[model samples]
Target: MEGGGGEQALSADNVRGIVLALISSGFIGGSFIIKKKGLRRAAAASGIGAGVGGHSYLLEPLWWVGMITMIVGEIANFVAYAFAPAVLVTPLGALSIIVSAVLAHFILKERLQALGVLGCVMCITGSMVIVIHAPQEQEIASVKEIWKLATQPSFLLYVALVIVMVSVLMFHFSPLWGQSNVLIYTAICSLMGSLSVMSVKALGTSLKLTFEGTNQLVYPETWFFVLVVSTCVLTQMNYLNKALDTFNTAIVSPIYYVMFTTLTILASIIMFKDWSGQSLGSITSEICGLIVVLSGTILLHVTKDYERIPQSKSIYAPLSPSLTTRLTGELLDHVEDGRASDEEKVLRRQEMF
Candidate 1:
């Protein structure tokens, strides 16, 4: 399955990547639920939640088990990067969100509201749009070229802004609002994720070039990127785990997806100019897709419960326009009768009942 224009043909590597992504999603999803359960148990024993002033989860064996599971997923994800395009692998993380949502419903008794489901759909749709139209990884002539990209004024400025944002989030916002707001922690993780992606891309390119016998391992810049990637990833994982402990697992996944994907793509565009080679139509589609994704995140945040079956016979009718229309059809048989065929009228009457 070759992609149109600049896309990699689906190869064995791509297939292997997709499979690993699926496995990673399953493990990561289960890990989140298990860890949250551990956190809850710890918080209960400690007489406070982590968001407030609890730390007993630090010694919880279950939490450590979940952490080990997550590490396995991360290792799989690391290998995935070597196999597939980032665009392909990153958006596929939606599988983890779905897994988390379903597990939360069963294990945590947390419901997935209709709006949240819609949000997940929109997020997945937008991510696919971005992935499909995304720019292919540029061929790296050398690790030095990557260093040059990192040192570019625009990217340097972006890095500086990320540092400032993370600082404000940690030192300024976290102290005052950390207990109540999941954003403080999630924001830190997402900001670092953007930087980590850049470093990972550089390191990935280095490895690829090295595999090709270019021998990039000799370059100090390659090792520098590796160090940057490791630091950023660890920081992200720590904050992400904290976020999982503090908020509803259902909420965390979509919000994290929206934040992480949006920032990573933004950083990639800024640093790599991935859009530079794309046509205006493609760029417009990608932007529109991202907007759709943002809309979904908003929907997730504003989640309302789905309509449930009424337990009583009173049948409390909703005030939605569709409900109103359904009710109106019951009384307007005379008006609508002649306009419909016998079959249509039968179905209409059936719906009214």
Candidate 2:
């Protein structure tokens, strides 16, 4: 009877993990597409409106809109992770590439080669397999408990300091922009997202403190954890963004999720001490899932080509005889009609040459 009950519990856990993974994957995939589009629009607006004075009111609105979208995405992500197994949740996030690819096809009109398509398929298959076959019945402690643990003064101070230091480094080094603009943009988006989550938490606490007459407002630990989580997320996102910049979104996104999922699972073991006393079969499944993830990542590099179409040479190259003659004639006519001055003609001629 006990054995049967254990088996049933395991099955239930497996199902939960799979469902969580799927939800996380879909949300993250959608978020990436939205973020990319928003960023592109913002960049264009900044370029067009920021003239010689380099000041534009348009920038504020665009930045805020992007920030809001990012915040919403992160909230969805956190909710999904809270319910699902970290391993399952993390790997499913890789579905962003699939989402990005589809969106890019319809919106950006970016052509996808056969290799890109194959890579996408491999990534999807591997990610699904990893999630579906993940070991079940792992115990997760309540978020409230985690929050309490994080609230300890020593731990709170340490996390707070770490987050501050990392934020400073990110701002000063601007690693993403220097190494890869896409990464920089993604990091900025993630930072905003993390802050948004922290803000939401603060608002909730404030309400509780105000209406319920609780003393939650005085807890520094609450803010400290918020900063820690946000910084950690931002740092991870930087690397993920860099990966996406070079590889097809389909390929890169899945791999990132896989990496994170694996990390989360490992962390769970070390930090939470969950999954203890698991059967050999369950352990094997976890190992096999990791192998599948590795295979998918390998397939991404194997089936992908990074060659870009060489841009056409400019139509307005250095002045040739024909162009020079045409410009000179136009200038001569303008001068003869008194539409321009002699100095203007000379200046125009010099410009053509």
Candidate 3:
């Protein structure tokens, strides 16, 4: 069937892609907390961290477990991208933010405020909207067809812009502000990630077609995509480790998700014209859905450090306004104290490095 301008019925392939994306989100979300625990353990043992160019996390078993889990999730994600449009597959990643936030609250001792809960709800609602209005996947018969799409002038311009920005971040801004600012490292990872995802989709399609009896391995474009995927993945992993080790998992996950998803969608629209046949209303809805998701993610990022003030009395017990104000003040002081302690420890470790 041709692509529709309205809500298209989910094909079998689309269903498979959705299921795999959900599973991938679960694994990826949990991996963030597990890996953070490992990073803390490694820093305690070696007096350094990935943020400060430390390599001790490689010796930590828990870190390896997290890495393996993420790899599995990414593999599933790769296949989903192959079968579905990026517009459909990319926004679904917001589910992982929910997973990460809940896990971080329980496991990492990061308190999720009431706003955080609302943020998670917004992410889910937005994801559902995108799923309902998602554009249909464009059909491509061979790896070369994907290559042709990728090499189009519009996509080439985007590729060029990404390269230039990445170069500036790596060579100039990174040296000056990378360690101090979370955005520096996360931006690098996100930019590289967008390109890597495109390469993954192409390579995945090649493998899928190959398994279906047509040989894509004979083409140089297939191998070229493999090379791009390899390089981009490595770059993303390196910088992402730095971001994760140096910052709160709650903050890193949502920011990375937002940036990566946005760029991947932009690249897909440029390269594949995924929105070509969509109705204006459907397109507007998808954009609104994306905005809601981004708003939720930003809420998560801003409120990740906030905790609900606990009350001494329960069962609808009344309290004076003065008492409530005192409790809230105490909570703020406690949170600030904990943040200061953590920062002090990181500074000491960086000095050692």
Candidate 4:
């Protein structure tokens, strides 16, 4: 009876997590539009932009509102992780891409071409597949256990690799190409994001256990997780702001989602081994889903580049009768003024020229 009851409770927890994730997606999606508007306002007023490393958006009230919204959404997401597996929680973030793209189309006056729409559908489909096959969260009892998993050689190696690459990207490539290329900013955010998520999950677990009376707060390891989450979140926010200010939101959201989601999943798989004990077919399906995601990402970038190619104007376009008549009248007026006084003629010549 106790075992049955525990299973039932786990099911309920999963449902609750899903609801929280959906709500978080909506808030995060809307926050993108609001913050983007704030960035635009700041740039227009201060003649500087976040893309150029400007901090003027810090002064914009609307930006603060967006930041608050994001914080609320992130809090919800943080809790969702406590209730469910990272694989389940992370893929659901594809929903935010839909929200951001739709809002950008209507509010920001950004056009999402047909291919871009198709790409979004593919991304969502892939994410849903991954979610459906996602394994349940591994049971964690204490912050010490999480700290142990984190200190494993494999996970530590992943952390080291992330730190080294981020340093190179930050110190070398960003100054030379960040403004022109969207990937540089997005990459930095995504890389930090993988580590941040692990830390967030650790902290969330710590808080959850504390609430349940285990009192995880006493451990210094819990505080270490807290510090990591804080640094990573701040870093993500900084580069994400730059990406938004520099590129189209329609473009930034999905690319960031793909990169972030992919890296997070990799990190989770490495740390949590979320796929362990899964059926072969289930694992195959997840791989297929990732392929679909990559295809969608490529399609989106190609479509965006295609849209940028200027259309050739037709030389044989017909003029309206009114326009033709107006041109003829103007020509006749100029023709009729055949001669003038020397001074006036010279002035007229200057004006015409």
Q: Estimate each model's TM-score.
A: 0.61, 0.50, 0.72, 0.66
lDDT of 2: 0.41
Whole-model lDDT per candidate: 0.63, 0.41, 0.70, 0.66
Worst 10 residues of 2 by lDDT: 322-331
Tens-place lDDT per residue, model 3, 1-353, is 22235456877777788888888788777776667777778778887655445678789998789768766776777788878877788777767768878987798666789998998998898888787878877777999899999999999999999999999999999899987788998898778777877888888888889989999999999999989977886777677666655654455556776787788888888988988878987788788899898788778667753222211111111111111000000000111223333323332222100
TM-score of 4: 0.66
TM-score of 2: 0.50
Q: In candidate 4, what are the lDDT values of residues 102-179, reduced to their tens digit?
A: 787798776778987997888788766765666667778999999999999999999999999999989999999998
Count: clashes, candidate 2? 4
What TM-score does candidate 3 get on C-alpha atoms? Answer: 0.72
Most lDDT-accurate candidate: 3
Query: Which of 3 and 4 is ahead in TM-score?
Result: 3
lDDT of 3 at 236: 75
Candidate 4 Cα outliers beyond 4 Å, as residue runs: 1-12, 31-69, 103-113, 172-185, 238-255, 293-353
Better model by TM-score, 1 or 3? Answer: 3
Clashing pairs in 1: none
